[model samples]
Target: METVVDGTGRAGRSGRRWRITSMQVLCALLVLAILGQDLLREAFDAPVLQTAATVFVAICVQALPFLVLGVLLSGAIAAFVPARALRRVLPRRDSAAVGVAGMSGVVLAGCECASVPVARRLIGQGVAPAAALAFLLAAPAVNPIVLVSTAVAFPGEPAMVAARFAGSLATALIMGWLWLRWGKLEWIAERALRRLPDTEGRDRWRVFAETARADLVDAAGFLVLGALVAAVFGVVIPGDWFSSLGEQIVLGILVMAVLAVVLSLCSEADAFVAASLSALPLLPRLVFLVVGPAIDAKLFALQAGTFGRAFALRFAPVTFVVAIGCGVAAGLLFLGGVR
Candidate 1:
């Protein structure tokens, strides 16, 4: 009987060791894709398929650099910046810290992919969750890099850049204050709250490298998924949707807002995508830019993984609603009633 039990335990251990991983499945799929390249080429002969492929490549290429930069910065902050130092820099009051945190996004330029891990790290390092959350929403949308990209994308409409900045900043500030008022600490995962060991000398650099690598790995898969979804939607969504929405302002805003979440375009690249939709009025496009970096499918996933599903479920929907309202208000103020 003992021999039988030992044999069963051994078999169980062996089975666990041989269990398939997501990475292995991905590699197998990649190999099959490479082997069937000719078939894929033929399949992509359809205009819709070709368009989807183009969009996938374009989004991946455009966003990856910014994503990389964001992770690197996040790593640096995690490694070099002490919790005490951060505490000293921000106001003692959470409400005041929220505003400062939102404004700080102007200097700390990064895409939404970078913000999740960074915010989680900040929370772990003893920063107020509200302040960190504010930074998460603001960094991607209000950063100089994103603003400059918006300006470049809409050279003829300088107001777009201003509107985007104002809208995004407002969303961050409002969310931060709201979190301060009602958010419970228990909603965040214990893993996110656990502080990293403080390291000195060469160990800090090692921490930086490890943190950045882990963050990149964690976030990149979701980024690819988001790009795929966006690409598929790009082809599936008829061109007539844009042309017809011009006359239906309310419908246009709602559609564009939903598209923003579904597309999950990088904050830096979304301005260009919005600019390409010439058929839509300025208001809907502004909503697209503002809503995207604040809460999208990818961002929602990142938040869920980093902060906890409870936090994400509550936060994402509120952010989406806040972003739309802020976007509309900014559009009216800056674009003069969305002309």
Candidate 2:
């Protein structure tokens, strides 16, 4: 029967994958053993290498709990919630749904890392992909914790917080509309569309646990990879770039935007980082805050893992451009030419 053939094929593939993973792990261990502690110490003695390692560990430690929370929430949504019910709850019109999704982001208090898996779950659960993506972009930027932190970080600059909120919200909405208009379903990885099997009977808890564990493992690996990449950039990027204000305003905006993507700071703390860069004008800092949550190295890795490389490649660049423009417009309107 066809079912038997399919099952056999699946088992064969699983076995091959397991063997490959084991071999890879064994090889890694062997290499590490060969290098020994003295080599590692020698390497770490270099200032740049040491700094990168420190950043890698710090990012992993800070993000691990939120990543766990994200996977667990995603698993709960998959196991207990009905896609039909979610569809019913969302607005009928896609445009309206996008707006609703952007606004709904206020409820999620976690950082950018948390939103990646959650957005993928939303798409798999029958929500419009564009709307879900909007929520993903908005959540970390516009959440109450982020807003409040911004307020506290810049005590006297109420306009800074307002501009940040407005710019981030605008970026989300614009990306949603752009996706709806131009995005192709095939651009998303096929794996993202596949639904988690139902566990209505005795296997509900097992399903939840398995789903969460698998997502955690997969996402955590990519998160670590991203953190490593970010660490390298962190060491390479000059500190003087933040300290020295360039005469050309456009250059400052562009540098801040690029730095945001490179830094990959947590949304809850990014406001403080931006605030600490007092040498930069409010406009550039606003761009940094808005762009960090929307698209960063870690977020891009998470997206590529969750959605697809094709999707991330197209999405991240567009988001960067949109965030910059939105930040500029918002700055002009709210900060009145960047105080």
Error of 1 at 140 (Å): 2.9
> Relative to the true structure, how large is the alpha-carbon lDDT of every model?
0.82, 0.78
Top-lDDT candidate index? 1
Regions of model 1 farther than 4 Å from truth: 1-16, 19-23, 110-114, 120-126, 152-156, 182-202, 217-235, 265-269, 272-278, 301-313
| Cα lDDT tens digits for candidate 1, 119-175 | 876787788999999999998889876887788768888889999999999999999
Q: Which pairs of residues collide in model 1?
A: none
Question: Mind giving the per-residue lDDT tens digits that candidate 2 earns over 29-119?
Answer: 9889787978878878998898888877876675565566656755665466544444566797999999988887776544577678767
TM agreement with the true structure for every prediction: 0.79, 0.67
**What lDDT score goes with residue 51 in model 2?**
81
Best by TM-score: 1
For model 1, the local distance difference test gives 0.82
